[model samples]
Target: MTQSPAIPLPPPAERRRLREAQSLTQAQVAERVGVGRDTVRAWEAGRTTPRGRKAQTYASLLAAASATAHEVTLRQADPTAPLTPLTPAQAFDALYAFCAPALVRQAYLLTGRRELARESVERAFQLAWHRWPEVAVDPDPAGWVRATVYECALSPWHRFRARHRHPEAPPADPADRALLAVLLRLPPPYRRTLLLYDGVGLGLPETAAETEASTPATANRLLHAREAVAARLPDLADPALLSRRLAEVAAHERLRAARPPVVRAGSERRARNWTHAAIAFTVALIGATTFTLHTAPTQYNPPVAPGATVQGVPPRAAPGALSRAELDLRTKLQRAATNGPERLTPDAR
Candidate 1:
């Protein structure tokens, strides 16, 4: 006899969205799913996926959540409905609350640093809040934010940070520590691809789309990553088991995300600050340009010559016939030819 097909679970972000839409908390969902709260958190965050009977149970829960959310949405859409649509802030907050926790864990998996992971997710969300118009209209806002977080977390520039120059402490579990060490040894691209594909349970096409790589390239990276991991730990030969293990290594209990309200408030505050700074910079720039236009000389101007003493001029003699007159008379006497005294006297007159 042929077996029935398995139920397809929604993406991690969508799972969280459905649960949130129904106003269900992680603990509540865990109670219903017969799993620990942390396990539910891991599943929602994309750090891990449940398998076999548990997978079926989880899928069922998500399906019920989706149905409930749909009913609520339908009721709200009626013309005579009393419900109000979400405000921009409400939507932003909803997206943040739904995904930030999982993003933090995913980032921690990628970088193996709790602080950096938390910081990356916060910064990404703040940026999303800043560009709310674009993010709001996006087909997959969660994916947009996740991409931003990945970029920030995996940035090569982090190497230059003094604090990040040294490694943080390793995980408490020897297996987790060993797994993390091996994962870190893989090149960043391969590591990221592996996390998104194997760890996150994303299909090849979805993983490729998220990683911004071609299907062939993503597949190649995943294969190489698997080979590398298997070389060290042959027990994780199965892709499904590898994904689960990856999730555990990345989602340490120590990595806690900030409260949703805090993250939302911070994002709004950051956006306001950015707006204020841009305004200030623009005003300053205009003022600087205006000052330049007003104060700066318009045309070339040659410098004026300084005064100097006149050469070849005699000093003033006390008004004896005016000094120039006396000098002229002495010059005339020296030039006159020496004639008879009487003739000289008549001629001098």
Candidate 2:
């Protein structure tokens, strides 16, 4: 019988919990995941993202084992409550209700396109539904959904598609348009930092954690972001005033401010249909656009070492081709090689 591969590692914070739930040591996990123990340690410690097929298997194994243990614990804790697995429908409904509105607003703020924001948020929620088992148990499920939305908003294919569509609501006045234009003109990192900080009202540490930067580095980015915005739009220089203005702009521009409707219980087919539709649309778009996705590999060759020649390639000796310095160096090396034994004499030396 073929043994199934281990599941991929979950988020760094939850790795330990998942491991402990299965009563597995790091060594056991490493062996199962087909990685070194130190690799498992690095994953649990948040030093790196678990890469490759083993990562997916490791996460699957942990989530499956964790679900079983979780249900057992729940049953022990409460006799009346059923020990049912969390279904896709329930997870989708819960995450959508909790996160949809805020994520819509964040997407709008990021993209400056209202309809695009709605679509991005829904698409992210749909994806969350498909992977609910893994995502539902994440330490910050809402954050996970939000990150997915952010990815959708920033995707190049989506951006290209969005260029032809008009925004649902254009700015009513020139000032609003100017402010938004300047805000969007900032670099992506600075813009995201500003939105997470000023627009979403996340504190320094939370924003830092979300952006995967240290607190000090997040602060520096925020400061520079403020300075850049202030330099361009002098009225926005004041931190408090900027935050208030951002809130007001977002309020005015948000297409949907209401929470998503509850997905009925046992509507797994409905949820799957929604997710499948999104996937189909994305596929169609890719086909229509002839989009080619490029992935960077984990390893690449460095440039040729200094002073090393390619094998079988003779030095350039043509008069015009050789620079004076190059010619001098080559001539000196050739002379030294030719004169080696004879030049070893004391007088020659």
Candidate 3:
């Protein structure tokens, strides 16, 4: 097969400036290019150059961005010139169209589930659509979406979810089934490394960075994974042959990605739903707070304690009962005291 067309790139410094001028992040560029953010950073830093298909894609993106900027400049210079810029939806659709089909196929290779592959691809694109501002000028929008797809397709969490609890039917072809089984046997990290390096045609450094491993470690994983594959399928011993076989396996699957408009509309609908939910939650919280404020007690009324005797004070003694002599004098006074003051008074002290 003929190689993709490659073009001369500007000096590394200028290349970075061109991307920066477009307000594109290194991470976005890397995502589109199917490499790690750090790989793009390395490209900008002049530590490396993009190669093969990735190089061609990178060049095309830069050139297109540069051309657009020039168009904008010319429009600004001559206000009457009709200005055209890619709308977010249009840009998103382009990105989805370019990446979705291949992503679905790749995802199937990873999960060996056609439905899951399609779902993962759609989910990834949905996320990209949600973060269009970031994805729009991303140097590698495809890569960004691809990473999400890979994560979604290979997530262990999916196994626990109801829909994905049981394993899907294996491929009809024994060889395809066996290959998938073997791929699944390898650890996720090793499997991912092999796919990116061999199947996806990523450079060693790019693969290592994307996999979040050091170059040496990535190399080790690749070696071990390849060794396992070669030991199992001796005929596909060569790396190129192995890569080709992987492609063949992926191509054999008839998975179809959701259409661009459907994906875009779904993304919008999902975002809208989330926004409405958030607003509802906020309103509920505000209402609850208001209700509490209005219904709460207005003043503090201290509780009254039961009465108790005074501490440290003695009780007064009760008077003795009236004596007999006092009673006799009281009787006499009652009978004689009406007319005489002397009679009312007692004679004895």
Q: What lDDT does each candidate get?
A: 0.77, 0.68, 0.78
lDDT score for candidate 1 against the true structure: 0.77
As a TM-score, model 2 comes out at 0.49
lDDT of 3 by residue, 164-186 (tens): 87889988888878888889888
Write candidate 2's Cα lDDT for 1-349 as tens digits. Answer: 1111111234566778878877889999899889999988887787654533554456556656566565667778999996687566544554464356657767777777877777777777666666777886786666677678877876667645655354445578677777788877877778888877776556788778878889999899999999988998898888767766765666565367334342232235667777899999999988766643444445788998778678998867676677789889999999989978754446654
lDDT by residue for model 1 (3-120), tens: 1111145677898998898898999989887899999999888776665445546665675566567557757678587665566776776666556776887888789898999999
RMSD of each: 11.6, 23.8, 13.8
**Deviation in angstroms for 117 in model 1?**
0.7
Better of 2 and 3 by lDDT: 3
Once fitted onto the true fold, the runs of candidate 1 whose alpha carbons sit more than 4 angstroms away are 1-81, 301-349
Q: State how far residue 339 of model 1 sits from its true place (Å).
A: 29
Question: How does model 1 score by TM-score?
Answer: 0.65
Q: How close is every model to the real structure, measured as TM-score?
A: 0.65, 0.49, 0.65
